[model samples]
Each structure stands twice: as structure tokens, then as C-alpha cells.
Target: MTGKTVVITGASSGIGRQAATELADRGARIAVVGRHRARAEAVAAEVGGVAFIADFDRLDDVRTLADDLLFACDRIDVLANNAGGLVPTRTLTVDGHERTFQSNHLAPFLLTQLLLPRLIESGARVISTASVANRWARLRLDDLNWAQRPWLGGWGAYGTSKLETILFTEELARRTAGTGVSAYSFHPGFVATSFGHGSPLMALIALMSGGRYGISVEAGAVPLIELASTLDPGFPSGTYFDTLTGNGRRHRLAGDADLAAALWQRSAELVGCVPAR
Candidate 1:
């Protein structure tokens, strides 16, 4: 991995941070991205790489980030779409979409589209940090903004966004077929992280997975590290891996070709992205 440039979002903390550190230790140059400049810069300095600050809640920030990365690196060997979380409350971004959905799905989707040309040129691996939470998701294409759904707090919104993420990976792989670039998504397991601090759901998670049963941040980063390093077996593009089992598995909706296609179209429409080619 020496001399390879890898772009990792959410690299300021948790699994993302751990993965960035490990990858840097292996001599891969890292681009640490975060919403806060101070934290991002700190991580970047530690890893001997560059820092990019971009808040996913704003589409403009995502655009600026893509431009900065394209300018900073001649080639990006790996692009890790690892920044995402469940908002404690149902909030909306400036773009008028639900906060969780925009941050977790739309922003990364748009950023990947904007960087597709370069990614293909470098034959980069696109790794999305999806989740096992997709099993509980109830996708509502018409109500993706969560405008009409019965509010069950923010879990539903987060889960649906994850489902969309897995589908996005599938469609991306299909679209980028024969381009030498690969797209993949994976569950990072229920790691002990500050992912949803101050939320009731997070409180429950801490209680359930704390101590002897909890998965460490480094443990949760294994699959990501493998995928980004391309160390795993010859897994097909668009495959989603279950980190819990350490093997490829079909997500609840990830197998439906029609659904994946529909999601790609809907997501591209939402993010104002026209897929390259």
C-alpha cells in the first residue's frame, strides 16, 4: 500500500479514524475528511496527510471537497465513503432533505459521481460503510424525505438511508462495469463508538454492547481495511459483506436488480447527478 493515496471521510473519529491510522502505518497516504477543521487537521497531521473539512449537511461543501481532493492528489487508489450517522432528532439540511438521509446517502452519492472520472482513471476501489441496519429499513421511495412517514424517531430514517446506500453500491458497480473501478459496501458491526451520542438509541447500544461484548473500533474497521487494501478474495463488484460473519451476504433489498436500478435513478435525481457514461 506504500505510496497509494486513499481518501477517507469521517476520518476524525471511531472506525474511520482507526482505519486511517492503520492504513497510514502501512504507508498509504491518507486524506482525512471531517466536518470540523480542527479535528480533521489533527488526524491528517498524525497520519502525515492532508485534511479536508466538509459538512455533509450542505451539498456545496461536498462539491468543494471533491474539487480539493481532485487537486490535491494525482491519483486516489481508494475512496472510503465512511462518514455517516443517525441524528438524534429528525432534522433537515439546507438542501431540504432529512439530515440523516442527506449526510449518509445523498452527499456521498454526489461526491462519488463528481469524482467518478478520476476514480475510473486510477482504478480506485469505492468502499461504502453500510450497515446490518438495512434489514430493519423500510424504504419509501416517495417519502424518502420522511415527510409522510409516521415518525418513529430517527431510527427509521437512518435505516432507510443505509438500505439506500447498499443499493447505491450495487448500482454503481453495475454502471461502472468493465471500467476497472470497483464499488462495494459492508457492515461494520455494532462497534463501540460515539456515533449517536446523547440519543436514546445510542444509550441502549452502549448498554447492550459495552464491556466484554462490545466490538472495538479497530475490530469494526477490519472489513473496511481489507476492502480498501484489496486484500480479500476476488469478491465481485457491488458485493455487500457482513462484517459479523466476515463474508459476503445479500442485504435484504440489495439483491433486487430492479430495486437497485430504481434507487440509482431516484438517488441521482435527488443529488442532481448524472452518472458518467
Candidate 2:
């Protein structure tokens, strides 16, 4: 990993933060991204890397962050779209999209699209963090913005967004099929982190799950690190992985290629980016 330039969003805490530290320790150049400038800078300082502050709540900030990151690095060897959380309330972003959906799905979708040229040029890999919760999601594609009927709670919204993440990864991999760059989504396992801090219900669930179900952040990051640095050029793309347990562990719904393709089309429309042919 020495000398490789890697960009990670949500690096201020959780699995992203742990991955940044581990990768930087291996001599990789890190770009730490977070909503809070101070926290982002602190992580950057700890890893001897650069800091980028941008709130995922706004679409314009997503574009600005992409541009700034491109300006900072000659090439991005790896991009971990790890900045995301579940908002229990039905809040609308400045762009008028539901907060949870926009943050967890659209933000990464747009960022990845904007950075595709650079990723292609540098032969970079893209890794997105999804969750096992995708299985329970009942996707309402017709009312994705939640204007027709508001989300009942935050957990449902979060699960829907994660399902979209898996779909996006599948379609993105198909589009980049023959290219050196690959796209993958994975469940980091349940980790003890601040991921649930935004919602009390989530925090309670995390607390109750306790240390047994929740692994260390470092342990959760193992698959991410492997996906980033693996030398296997022939590794499969568009696959969902779960901590070495193989395919069966993933939600059956997550593997629906038809739904995945539709979600990809919708995401491209939402982000205003043309999907790579």
C-alpha cells in the first residue's frame, strides 16, 4: 500500500477512520473526508494526510468535494464511499431529497460518478459500505423521495438506502466490466462505532447488541483493506461479501440483478450523471 493515494469519506470515525489509520500506517497517502473540518483535519494529521470537509446534506457540496479531491491528487488509487448514516426522522435536505436516502445513497452515487474519469485513469478501485439490513427493506421506487408517504421510521429509510447501495455497486461493476477498475459492496459486520449516534433507536440497538455481536472497527475493516489492496486482477466485481462467509450470508434481495439495474438507472437520474455504458 506504500505510496498509493487513497481517498476515504467519513474518516472522522468508525470503520472508515480505522481503515485510514491502517492504510496510512502501510505508507499510503490518505485523503480524510468528514462533515466536521476539525475532526477531518485531526484524522489527517494523525495519518500524515490531507483533510477535506464537506457536508453530505447538500448536493453541491458533494460536487465541490469531488473537484477539490481531484485537484489534490494526481490519481486516486482507491475510493471508499464510507460517509453515511441513518436519520430516523423524515428530514429533507437542501436539495429537497429525503435526508437518509440522499446521504447514504445519492451522495456516494454522485461522488463516484464525478470521480469516474480519475478512477479510470488511475485504475482505482471503488468500495462502498452497505449493511445486512438491506434484506428487510421494502423498496418503494415510485416514492423514493418520500413525498407521497413519509417513512414510518429511520430504520426503514436506512435499510432502503443500503439496498440502493448494493444495487448501485452491482450496476457500476457491470458498466466497468472490462476496465481495470472494479466496484464492490460489503457488510462490515456489526461494529462498535458512532454510526448510530444520529438516532436514539439505533444507539439503543447498538447498545443492546453489545460487544459480542459488534466487532472491533479494525476487524470490520479487514475486508475493505483486502478489497483495496488485493493483487488478484481477475477478482469478481458486483459481488456482495460478508466477512469471509461467502454469498449465502447476503440478503437474497441484494442479488436481484433486475432490481439492481433499475436502481442504477434511477440513481443516475437522481445524481444527473450518465451511467458508463
Candidate 1, residues 109-173, lDDT tens digits: the string is: 99999999999999989999998888779897888889887757688888888888888998989
Tens digit of per-residue lDDT, candidate 2, span 1-277:
9989999999998888899998998889999999999999999999999999989999999999999999999999999998898776788999989998899999999999999989999888899988888876768789787677656667777878888888888888888888778888888888877776657766677668763457898899887777777765244787777754445255567778888888878878877778544
What residue pairs are clashing in model 1?
Answer: none
Sliding window of 10 residues with minimal summed lDDT for model 1: 244-253
The runs of at least 3 residues in candidate 2 whose Cα sits more than 4 Å from the true structure, single-residue gaps closed, are: 206-213, 233-235, 275-277
TM-score of candidate 1 relative to the true fold:
0.94
lDDT of each: 0.87, 0.84
Query: Could you tell me the C-alpha RMSD of candidate 1 in Å?
Result: 2.0
**Clashing pairs for predicted structure model 2, backbone only:** none
TM per prediction: 0.94, 0.92
- Lowest summed lDDT across 10 adjacent residues in model 2 is found at 243-252
